[model samples]
Target: MEPCERARLHAYFSKIASQFAPAEPAASFLVTHLLAERPAFVRAVAAMSRLRAVLPKPKSVNAAAQREVEQAIPCDTLSRELFTDPDTALNYLESRAPGESIVLLDVGGYFTPTISELHSRFSGQILGVIEDTENGHRRYADVDKLPCPVVSVARSPLKDPEDFLVGQSVVFSTEAVMRDRGDILHGRPALVIGFGKLGSSIARLLHAKGVQVTVYDIDPVRRTQALSQGFVVARDREATLAGAGLVLCATGSLSLRGEDFPHLRNGAYVATVTSSEDELELDGLPDVYTRTAASEHVTRYQTTGHYFYLANGGNAVNFLHGASVGPFIFLVQAEILAAIRMLTRAGLAPGMHEVSANDRAAIAATWLSYFNR
Candidate 1:
């Protein structure tokens, strides 16, 4: 976007920011910006971090699950699908269309759309990727083999896709923005609910930064492995929630005990994978209800959003933080997969990141339609 366009986008956001404060959810904010075609989103992190929400805590890592991951994860060959079919993958997403022009990216501790299915869905539309792992690249080597137009950006060019994607691209802002809210995370103790792709990524980030991290999950094996990795593991929610600063829920489970929140330090931050928003309640917390992303720090606050509904909202916490580092690999690869048959049909090239507002708007719309249906 040009300087003028960027400025106009900011103005638009300033106007709508107040109207949206009540939503207390990321999607409401993201989807709203998508609709306005205002790419320059006034990030929720910028809004919530101002208060310096004093949300912090610490705990032990879960045992059984950690041990299992330590034993099973480290040496596995991430190259092969192990046992997944590419064609079925595309079909699966086609069945779920969501009617949006999507850029498929992975979320930790959550199920992801398959490669072939994602490729088939966004044929000729995808361009770049934003990944946190080396394996993410190996899986789609064919795209990498393509020339120029298909180049991939390895580092978290938290800078801009303009470094790569130029003109009107349909992009997927995956894990990038998810873990961004530094104000919320500044001095907090953390807990990771699931250690799958999403959970593990965030846990590693927190630990690397020297924050006390505790892991919790249903898989007994994963629990043990995470512990061995040196992370403190908790036995259950009851054990993990005491005085916690931030809780990242990336699991498939829907409801967790309320006592977990009551014990949370007042003004604590709680974020989850975009997919898990409905699983837990953020309204009835012990004191002040703070709704924010793991990446961007905070999004909306239930305590202040009016008439606590226990529904704080959702954002891709993984994307929030992952964006902090980037070439925006995950969905960039997905978009490339989507554009494969169509764009690559003409010739081969490494897909780029920076996407067009039109493409993302379409994807968001389609995603909305699918979810509504």
Candidate 2:
């Protein structure tokens, strides 16, 4: 970690903590975090502690870093045991802190179901939920009636900058993975699946890199947006897949299923921007295809007539090389903190709500002032 970056993150964390610290610690937080040993995240966790007691449920992918965070700030033993097992995590949380007001501070909505269960099992104990990722926000949105008030910073304008930077990181990581295999991205026909914020950024960045970018989106509006932006929008998904040399899946959902794999151009490179295997459904890959290791970060799946390359073992390619979005992500993190603070107050009804615009503007202005200086 760069010293300047660490210092900036620490300063930003302090600013958020000072601004959002509750008058009285109102709720204990059950936090789902990617414990990636990133300075921005680590310091954010520390700042959350000032607001209330936080039970950090480390995403299973980064358990080693979870141990580092645990050593830095003691977490409940049960939170560690049930980190991957969501079904039991809530039960354990209830048992550990009986009658306490708990808030679900979630990433990727991994605990959405658990929060629902908590609401049903022990009503009013769950204060509210603060979701940080678009994927998670959608999960909560799908619920017919949320069990508690849910505030999300996932789609806030403050997050747009972070999403754009994440898109850049994804493409940069993909290029690095390609270079390792003696390949280049310049002038290659690439298909980008999903034309949302991150997907649009990826498509635009790829085009700027001299890659012929073809975009596909289930939403006709987004496809039109891509077309208006001057990228070729695919009318026939299979035909577009057949023509592309590279495929980047940015949709946080299962954009590519196993049945769709055969349409891919032979030796086409496929990567995802989402952290999980939600983008490419490799489990549905046909049995006809055999898998082989192409490199540390690349996997090759082949059949007699068709084959495609999976980068970063179907995980987000950006994470393969330390998904560095720099201090920009702190803006979104600060928004999540502000949401948590808002949840502590009364009068937020049960349903999905956006982080207040005032909070968003304040956080962004704070970021610009600090980074600009």
Could you tally the backbone clashes for each prediction? Answer: 97, 0
Residue-level lDDT of model 1, residues 256-314, one tens digit each, is 45445555555455655433333465444546655544333345444543321111244
Q: List candidate 1 stretches off by more than 4 Å.
A: 1-187, 252-260, 275-279, 282-312, 317-373
Which pairs clash (backbone N, Cα, C closer than 3 Å) in model 2? none
Candidate 2 similarity to native, TM-score: 0.89
Worst 10 residues of 2 by lDDT: 51-60
Which tens-of-lDDT digit does each residue in 1-373 have in candidate 2?
A: 5688668777878887788876555555545445464435555644554323345432234666666665655455433235345557656665555677666677667666566667766533777888888887898899878878989888899888889998998999999999999989976799999999999999999988889999999999998899999999999999999999999998888888988989988878999986545677788888888989998889899999887899977778887766767667778888877876787774789999988888888888888878876
Model 2 residue 152 CA deviation (Å) reads: 0.8
Query: Model 1, 268: alpha-carbon shift in Å?
Result: 2.0
TM-scores across all candidates?
0.37, 0.89
